[model samples]
Target chain A: MKKYTYTDKKDTRSGFGAGILELGRTNPNVVALTADLAGSLKLEGFIKEFPDRFIQCGISEANMIGVSAGLTIGGKIPFATTFANFATGRVYDQIRQSVAYSGKNVKICASHAGLTLGEDGATHQILEDLGMMKMLPNMTVITPCDYNQTKAATIAIADYQGPVYLRFGRPVIPIFTPADQKFEIGKALMLNEGPDVSIFATGHLVWEAIQAGEKLAEEGIEAEIINIHTIKPLDEEAILTSVRKTRCAVSAEEHQLNGGLGDSIAQTLARNYPAPLEMIGVHDSFGESGTPAQLMQKYGLTADKIVEAAKRAMERRV
Target chain B: METQQLEQIAVQVRRDILRMVHAVNSGHPGGSLGCTDLFVALYFDVLRLKRDDQGKVIFDMDGRDEDLFFLSNGHISPVWYSVLARAGYFPVSELSTFRKIDSRLQGHPATAEHLPGIRIASGSLGQGLSAACGAALAKRLNGDDKHVYVLMGDGEQQEGQVWEAASFAPHHKLGNLTAIIDLNHQQIDGPTDLVMNNRDLGEKYRAFGWNVTDMKGNDLADVLRTLHESKNDSEVPTLILMHTEMGYGVDFMMGSHKWHGVAPNDEQLATALNQLPITISDLKDY
Candidate 1:
């Protein structure tokens, strides 16, 4: 297993905040719009620095989406920020008609995704966002793992001229990725390489996968770990190459089992190379209020769950 | 252009709407006929349109330093397509391709086919005002002093997103944006008041902090004067409640909601064409 360590912990939304600040200074045409969540979205600095460019959309997610789509006409990049639930489910038709179908250059930056939103319960927690956004024809879905990666992804999306859904979370997680890394949109990062089992993870489950890799290595089992940041426009070549070598796979995410990263990887593997696959995610249930650690453990999103799934896949391998 | 000249173009446009819908045997002709005079006044007189060096019209999608218009009530795409062609946005002969397979002129206006003069796709209701607000803000950010115009159906105001956008524009002080509500009092189901009563539209816009005005949409002179007056400097966004008949200028179809989406048949088409004669101009027939 490849050695990985973190010196600090930070929330991914703060990374987005840092990225937008830099983008505001560099790109004059970059504008920010929030659906009454500027403080929660960590957009105060961007709003303060460039007051003229920011628009407080005042709890109107659908209108905010339409406005963002319209902003692209005269060469302005708009970032519409809100929670995951309101961002995807509440205003799906607006995004579908105005942004996705129109192919507008707008960034849908969603925070407080999955159970890691912590104590907000299922009403605020959204596990179906990735699937919903991925189903759209012209949408690129992304969920960066940590602060550094989320920051890099935020800045990188500005240069990409298309509609994108950048999903992040609220909990403060370990920052393991490099600070100055160039965030590639659809490329998978190989964290650890082995031949026994391939572990594909995204968002909060990425770090847990790394921990599982270390634990499996100590037990005389080799595990290959890959971080899938971009869910749609998925790196099929990288996933197939790893699964072909390992012969079995375990997918992990802080989302539902039906339409999360596991579902995506399962479809890709089923089409190309069938293998013994185990998924670690919420199994068709709503989350309740709890601490982030407790919720993750209760929902089977911990390293132990990944390690068990990896072992199960290896055992089922022919 | 003179008011008489604009009225002549509107007559030809009404003929085109009837013929185009009759050709496809499917389209919305009521609102298209009702809003023909307003479209003629804007395209011919009000807008500082894009023109080539020889003063001929040129169609450009990007509206920087130019007045931009959006049709929120996109069911009336026949009328928009007619005025767009008559204003030299595209060849007038393209009007025959309306709603045909693989044609740029979609049943509802769309940007997918790379159609000139269409910036966003808005078949779904209540999205155009928000888009216009975004464009207006973009023009302000780019230091371009231009206006943005959008038209909506009276029944389309029932959509929740329209109210959301309505609340947003006045709060943000979008002075350069003008929204015209086609108060024809008719919709797909029935009369808009019966389907869903929009009580006192002028008062509703006034309460939402808009500069409200009323105009006769079928009258070329009133449309020309009211549209010119609405463009003056103001502290709030402008809303013009244009009162018009459902199927104006057609004696049999006027003042009724039956012709909203149903196209005219052969006999009806001939009767409608006789009502709107081909004036002394070089406009072609499809």
Candidate 2:
């Protein structure tokens, strides 16, 4: 197993904020609209520096989405920012009709995704966003692993036209990926190469997969770790390629097992490559009040959970 | 175009709407007929369109320097399609394809087919105003003085998104925008007043910091005057409360919510077309 270390720990939302600020300095058409989560989304620097480009949409997520769709008509790329719950479930129709259906160049940036939203409880933690966004035609759903990758993904989606749902998080996590990593939409990034089991993970769960790979090495288990940032245009080729060699798979994400990264990978495998699989995620349940660390353990989204799933998948291999 | 010419266009447009809905056995002929004159006024006279060297209307997705129109209440697409076709955005013959399979003339207006003149897709109500506000903001950012117009149903104001947009445009001072609410007082279920009392609609917008104006939407001259007067790049947005009939030309379909989304039958279509005159640019030629 390859050794990975991080000196800096930052919330994925900060990467979004940094990416927008950097893009603000570079791209003139980069406009930011927030539904009163400017501070939480870490958009202060972008707002302060490029005040003219920032639209304060108050608490109206629906209007924010509509406006973002509208902004694209005048050659402006709009990034509508809000919490994951408000960004997806609350303003779904607005996004469906205006952004996705209309094929508008709008970035639906969501922070505080999954149980890690913590303390705010299950209402704020959105587990169904990936499915909701992925199902919409002309929509690109990207949930990057860490701060650097999130930042790179944010900058990259600006270049790609059409609707995009960029899901990030609130809690600070280790920044393991390179600061200058070139983020490619719909392309899988291989974190580690092993022979026993292929572990496909997304968002915060990618780091857990990496940690699980280290643990599996101690028990003479070689685990292959693959990072799936783009969930909609699922890199089926990568999953097929890695799984064909490993012959078994374990999928992990900070989302529901029913519709998250696991379900997507499962469908891909069922269609193209049939293999033994174990999915690690919230099993048709809601979250509760707990710290980010406590929630991960309670919800089975930790390194140990990934290791367990990987072992289960390997045992089921035919 | 003169007021008389605009009136002729309105008659042809109403005829087009009837024929379109009649052919498909589906479409909203009532609101389409009701909004015919307003559509004629905007497409023919008021909207500052961009054209090619051949005098053809050039449809650009990024309608930066052109006056953009968004139909938020998209069920009335028949009227808009008729007007757009007659104004040379597309061929007037294509109006026959309304609600047909693989036609750019969708049941509701959409940009998915790369249709000329439509910049946004709208059928679900109360969304267009927010989009218009966004385009207006982008125009303001780009230093473009062109205006954006969006039309919504009276019943659509019942949507919370409408009020949110009403509050938004004013707060952002989107003077480059004008939102028109069809004051026909009818929706899908029943009268807007009966379904959801949008009590004092003008008063609500006024309190939301809009410069509200009333216009006779069925009258071409009045629609022209109001649209021209409302064109501004001010700090305040304008709201035109367009008073129109549910079905203006067709007497039987007039003033009833029942005709809102229903297409005109054979005899009904003949009777409705009889009420409107055939213009110089005949629909048959297309």
Candidate 3:
């Protein structure tokens, strides 16, 4: 298995902040609008640098979305930031009609996603955001793994035309990817090249997949690991290639098992490769107020869970 | 255009609204009839449209230097379509395609068909003000000095997003945008007061930090003068409370919410046409 290390840990929202600040300096048309959650979204850096370009929407997610859609009319790229719950579920119709159906170039940056959003409980933690946004015709849904990749994605989405839903989390995680790595929208990065089982992971689960790869190596089970960042436009080619070589796959994500990355990969494999796949995610349940570690552990989203799923997939490959 | 010429166009626009809704058998003509004069005045006299080399007004989606208009109360699309065609945005013949399959003139104003006059799709109510503020901010950012106008139904103020947008404009100082509410006091269910009273709407907007004005929307001269006066420079945004009857010109449909979305029958259409007598100088029918 390929080895990986991190010198420091940082939250993905801060990566978004750093990226948008850079975009504010580079792209003249990039504007930021937040629904009274700039500090939580880590957009203070962007606001400090370009105060004129930032708009405080004062707890109105729907209006912020509509305004962002309107800003696209005059060729401005607007990033509407809020919690994942508010960004997707709270103002879904607004995003659907104003931004997605209208084909407006608006970036919906959501922080505090999934079970890791800890202590705020179920009302604030949204597990169905990816499914809701990905269903929209013109929406591109992206959930980067770590800080570096999130920053790269934040900068990359500004240049791409059309609406996008960029999902990131609150907890600080390992920054495994390179700081200057070029982030492609629908491309998967292969972390390990092995023939036993292909492990496809996204968001914060990418690091757990890496850990599973290392443990499987120690147990004489060589696992192939691939990071599937962009959920909507899934890297089908990469997934098919890895699964074709391994004959089995394991999908891991910090979302529900019903309509998330697992469903996408299962659908892809069911149509094309038809391989034995095991998924590790929250199974149609809401999360509670607990520490990030406790919540993730209760939700069965650790390295051991991925390893177990990988073994089950390998065993089921008959 | 002269006031008499504008009034003549408005009569033709009322005729077009009646005919279009009558043809489709499924459209909102009550608010459409009420807002016809306002639409006629804005398109014919208020808006500074882009002209081509041949000195004809060019109708395209881009509204950078030109004044932009959005119909929030999009059920009244018949009036907007008529005024837009009369202002040379498209051919008058397209009015026959209202609510038909594969037609640019949708039941409500939509950008899905790439219509030049519509910038955003708005039938959902209370979203147009946010969109207008966004466009106005864009103009400010692009160094373009132009105004953005949006029209909403009086009952649409009951939507919470309207209050959200109402608070947004003044806080952001989107003075380049103007919002007008057609205060006919009726919606699909019933009278707005019986459905839900907003108390005093002018005071609500004023408390939210907007420069408020009232205008007689059915009166062509009053609409022209009030709209012109409200577009003056100010630090706060402007809201024109336009008052008119639900069915202004037609006596049968007037002062009632029953005709809000109901289409007039053949006999009723004839009665409406008779009441709004068409002139040769009024409209070149499609």
Instruction: Report lDDT (CA) for all predictions.
Output: 0.92, 0.92, 0.91
In TM-score terms, which candidate is top? 2
Model 3: residues >4 Å from true position, as ranges?
B59-62, B280-286
Question: Clashes in model 1: which pairs?
Answer: none
Q: What is the C-alpha lDDT profile of model 3 across B44-77, one tens digit per residue?
A: 8999888899867876555788888888878889
Q: Between prediction 1 and prediction 3, which has the larger lDDT? A: 1
Candidate 1 local Cα displacement, residue A251, angstroms? 1.6
Winner on lDDT between 2 and 3 is: 2
- Name the runs in model 1 displaced over 4 angstroms: B280-286
lDDT of 1 by residue, A267-316 (tens): 99999999999999999999999999999989899999999999999999
Per-residue alpha-carbon lDDT of model 3 for A160-207, expressed as tens digits?
Answer: 998999999999999999999999998999989999999999999999
lDDT of 1 at B164: 87
Compute the lDDT for candidate 2. 0.92
Q: How well is candidate 1 docked (DockQ)?
A: 0.76
By DockQ: ranked, best first? 2, 1, 3
Better of 2 and 3 by DockQ: 2
Point out where model 2 deviates above 4 Å. none
For model 2, residues A81-125, the per-residue Cα lDDT tens digits are 999999999999999999988999999999999999999998899
Residue lDDT tens for model 2, B1-286: 9999888878888888888888878989888888888888888889889988997788889987889899999999999998998889899888877898989999999989988989899999889999999999989999999999999989889889999999999999988899999999998899888899989999999999999999999888889889999985488999999999999988899999999988878898888777776885556632
